[model samples]
Target: MQPIDPHSPGVMPSGLHASVVDQMGLAIGAGEWAAGSVMRIEELEERYGVSRSVIREVLRVLASMGMVESRRRVGVQVLPATEWNLYDRQVIRWRLASPGRVAQLRSLTELRTAVEPQAARLAALRAPVADASELMGLAGKLWAAGQDGDTELFLALDIQFHRLVLSSSGNEMFGKLNSLVAEVLTGRTHYSLMPEHPHDEALQLHVDVASAIQRRNPVDAHHSMLAIMERAMTEMSTLWDEAAHK
Candidate 1:
């Protein structure tokens, strides 16, 4: 699907409501306007220079995402961060942008554990050997670079690992999620709310999974990838619990 352009002029056509909704959803998730913050329709209208209809359209989209509540006099009140829908694609993007994005990252990482091992297993069975080999090659490069402490090289290669995994999985739904995963994992400083991970465990896990895939060992690939996600979850759980307290 083509990305929606928010920069265009005039009353955004009704067709663009989904795009508008996604943008507003992201802003709210990013904590652009904090909890209890009033998002006056007229003000947003002036801000976006779009029709009240479009603004409402965006707000309604946000409402559906559990990002806000609308009432007569109370107007639009931004709710607590946790209230927002974390699963919706657009909601996930917004949460990735939040100031406290570490918690969101933790959540995403946790989800990866549940979904990706199965994805890897299926990919092993379904993906052509050549495609799996290519992905494993990229993972090898990523592992070496990560061990070298080359953040740039490590990130680029890490992205390849996911793209290849999704492609190998041959599942369109999970493939679409790659875009969201890519954005969150890359340029993470934009919405950093968590501490940077110490050590090189993530890199090593990538190597193990890559090796498993290269050897066509679906079970090992599955469990190895799952272990990587598990460690991340464990580290992030304490942070998430602390954030929830506040």
Candidate 2:
């Protein structure tokens, strides 16, 4: 069977219920099916040229993501965007694909701002030597990439650097969020929200974070990471504002 294409504009994929799920997810994310909008099974079946069973399964997945609800008399109703599971990776991807994508990116960055500095502090006090060394190496490469105006390399290194910080925090909960952090990094680069040349101060803050972690200075690491995240929030919010008025 052909793999599902999310941008296919409602065309159902061949024999893949996942394709149906993606299409509906994109539609819901894009606001095509606004909150409280109800879709009947028969209508969906005819609309997508799919069987009731396929449509049912697809709707089940969407329901699990808190995107829709099925009632006894009422049909499948679209839930408010706030009801959707933003933490779910697939849901995050769907949101990133929508017109409200920059808003989603900003929201995720806010969450990162809250969590990552603490994770960096924990890593300073607890990460293994190998992880610390690797972080330092990545930080140096990030600096070079920034200086050379190598955006693609800088993006990859930046994601890896933050992912390592989260995973090396010695806190299970923090480690579990590595994927979410990865998505935000990828989203910024993919959407051109990142600056052509990363700021020198930003690059130095990354080095400071790595050095603090290496020296086991939790206080320094925490402050440095906080500065990094605060700068990121400002940069992304500026881009979001620009995009909104355009």
Candidate 3:
């Protein structure tokens, strides 16, 4: 294996190790790396043109994600799929690259539907006035951006809206669900909205949710979020099933 400086290609060297860890984890989970495979750092170092240090750093990251097992003399060996960390960002990416990933997303969405609507209600009871106002403001941003033929920004703010809502829930565990929430939403953007019609229907629901939360009406917030999730889950399920069959 040839050694090269990871910073030389330097497109995003800070993220390089993470990106490589994600890619390699994806390959392994997608069966390209296969079970029982031994991944020597020398070969990866040569392939990615990153240095041994960068490769080892990436391997250690992957090992932590439960994608690879490493020992001083034994090298890096891919672990069985069952051992992987589902919550690890790279592992989640890798899992989604496999054939049935959309179904996984659907399941996650269903789980979110269960958790987030309740969280919205809980948040309404205690969310700071500023947080409530901010939620309102984000909802407005989402609506205006969607109406302005800016689907990209709309989607970005849309995810942020939910993240903010979760953060307002006053529980660290609820806030930590942001990553899982982001994962589901980011991966399914194309499936959920078209560039041409991105802002059509979501505005009303988001407005309702924002207003309810601001009013500190927990029941109203609950219903508003629940209604939104129900529709989204139904639509997403159909879309995901179709994609799976294709």
- Give the higher-lDDT candidate: 2 or 3: 2
Indicate the TM-score of model 3.
0.80
For model 2, how many clashes?
0
Task: Compose the digit string of candidate 3's lDDT tens values, residues 144-219.
Answer: 8877877678778978999988999897888888888777777676545233454356678888888998998889
lDDT of 2 by residue, 39-118 (tens): 99998989777877789889999999999999878889999988988898889988898998888988898899899999
Clash number for candidate 3: 0
Model 3 weakest 10-residue run by lDDT: 191-200
Instruction: Compute each candidate's TM-score over C-alphas.
Output: 0.68, 0.89, 0.80
Can you rank all candidates by TM-score, best first?
A: 2, 3, 1
Deviation in Å, model 2, residue 35 alpha carbon: 1.1
Which ranges in model 3 have alpha carbons more than 4 Å from their true place?
A: 1-16, 42-46, 49-52, 71-75, 190-201, 241-246
- Candidate 1 lDDT over 83-106, as tens digits, reads 876666666666666665676686
Which runs in model 1 stand beyond 4 Å of their true positions?
Answer: 1-27, 30-39, 46-90, 187-201, 234-246
Q: Which ten residues in a row have the lowest lDDT in candidate 1?
A: 189-198
Candidate 3's displacement at residue 107, Å, is: 3.1
Q: After superposition, how far is residue 74 of candidate 3 from its true place, in Å?
A: 6.1
- Please tell me which predicted candidate would have the highest lDDT against the true structure: 2
lDDT of each: 0.72, 0.90, 0.78
